[model samples]
Target: MTVSAPIASRADAGGGTPQALLRLDAVGRRFGDTVAVDGVSLEVPAGEFLTLLGPSGCGKTTTLRMIAGFEHPTSGRVLIGGRDVTALPPQKRDVGMVFQNYALFPHLDVWENVAFGLKSRGERGAGVEAAVTRALGLVELEPYARRKVQALSGGQQQRVALARALAPEPPVLLLDEPLSNLDAALRERTRDELRALLKRLGMTAVFVTHDQEEAFALSDRIAVMDRGRLQQVGSPEALYGAPVNAFVASFLGRANFLPATVDSVDGDRAACTVAAGVTWRARLAADSPRGAGARVRLMARPEALTLAAADEPNALRARVLDRRFAGAATFYRMETEAGPELLVQGGPHTASPGDVAGICLVESAQPVAYAAEP
Candidate 1:
């Protein structure tokens, strides 16, 4: 029988710290020679909204489809609330699903579509009607309950779709780019509304989206993927402040990679040489595997590098390559004699195309090392 989505205190539903509700253990999927998802593993806590974020062909959607049972893993397992669901069919696994297309029954009114699950379960009468009302109310679409889905606007249609999924109150909700079809304005509005609603309802949801901003805004934790491989999974701050490698540092935002050779070490500060035969001191984790006399790459973010008056300390003299005006910010790309092209953000500096300036990287900014790939 359909029950009101449990009103229990859920972390996102304004309750407590959310706990893991789903886990994918080294899950993988392959089609012939092309792998869709590679040994991807992650956990989503109950009532926490998690998003799988990546670019096209990054296997984020494929991962979501696997969880929805549209595709099966070629290897590994799917666990929901700690139980293995790797072999379960879509219907057998009590999961609520929202699709990118807002697939609603054209023939059925909003109320009917919301109640379709209950009807399928052989439910009848007042209980089904009450559940349908509650679901519609949840999405603030109760007024349109009797309207045919075919007659609704895209936003309205999506609301109906959400109502349908929520009506059954499944232990888990799977959203596959649910707001991708909406316009930018509507998309932002809907995303915020959806996040709040999911929180208030205490729903354990897995959201899939390619928009970095969307993932950062809506998710409690984000799982980043690339070429079917899980890249990094953490809060947005964690991913931004401490990226694990070059790909992550580059993908998450702009970065400057300067080639340096270790001169000496003072605990974490390794005197390293950059381009132009200049040496700079950089901090490294004590446990860093980098050794003296070895070539290393120094990483720092745009904000970390600032325009400096003198070419001293860890300063690099750079010639401006390009300047881009991006509304609230202007990013400048400069070619440094000692590092890969560096990007600087958020200063209203209007340096002409060929102006030269000294750059300063805040101490300990992007103190990371990459094992030089063989």
Candidate 2:
């Protein structure tokens, strides 16, 4: 069962409008001679959760800062609800921000911290109290309203920070690795709560993370960035199933790339020969190169392969070099005479180290092909 429901907030009330809630047009930022973000462009629809995913120094954080108006772009425009806000200061942007450290005031109690946004905007008395109470309830923190920020646990502090950000009911929410400070187990649990809350409230959010699992779990769509440039933007399933390039295929999940030379193209399928002159069929990307002899790569996930009998057609004999038991599954590092080292995963009864096995790619594998990087 899914956790999403029909969005019924202000964002969707104007049902006929075609404009995106947030738009970035060729945005770029430079610091001295270093390019921090370059030519990044995307559109986020209202009530959708988008995640900026990449490694450190890849400009995910810089992009988020630009959206929040904390950093000005050098070359492009930022549009929120169809208005250009590139020159606006952080305070002027109606964006709620949650940081990695929570950033809650050490001396302020939960209630005061959450009410700060409303109070700054001239709200007071019963109205302010009511808004604070609602925000705390959304994060399940109403019982801890009088607790000091320093006295709460890490997860509790994160909840307080999130409550403070949402108290003002901003149209867009930006989170910069908000769960990074929590332990592994707590981070997992908190992420679940966060996703559910955003969906239930019909909130539009952009989350930044280097963790692939977190991005996959929370985003309706993911925008992958590298070296200050936008790489690919698509739904999580699309990004994982049909990655645009070698970098994306390897980064989003574990993929074994086999070097091959294209022999022929039949519609969207390509026949390629690997190391032993064994021909294999692979699916072609929409922009895949079709020229014969063009160097390309065949990508297959570890779970897509299985063990076959010695005489099975389209199978290769390999020896398991290492085995790791991971409870529900067993991972094997297998070396084949047909060439590259392949990582294969199977049930707990899979091959052990020193065992010889016949490895075969399942017909459902649908391996993707990409031009080999120079």
Q: Best candidate, lDDT-wise?
A: 2
Given candidate 2, what's the lDDT at residue 161?
Answer: 93
Per-candidate TM equals 0.87, 0.94
- Cα RMSD for candidates in order: 3.5, 2.7
Put down candidate 1 lDDT per residue, 1-374, tens digits, no spaces.
23345532433455556556788999999999999999988888877788898888999999998998889999999988677889999877778999999888888888889999889988899999888998888888878888888888888899999988988778889999999999999999999999988878777889998888898889888888899999888998898777766677667766777777777877756777776556666666333446788777777778777776445655688888889888887888988776468887647775755888778766656556544444
Off by over 4 Å in 1: 1-19, 265-269, 277-289, 310-313
Model 2, range 11-78, lDDT digits (tens) per residue? Answer: 66767653478899999999999999998999998888999999999999999999999999999999
Candidate 1: global Cα-lDDT?
0.80
RMSD of 1: 3.5
lDDT of 2: 0.88
Error of 1 at 36 (Å): 2.3
Largest TM-score belongs to which candidate?
A: 2
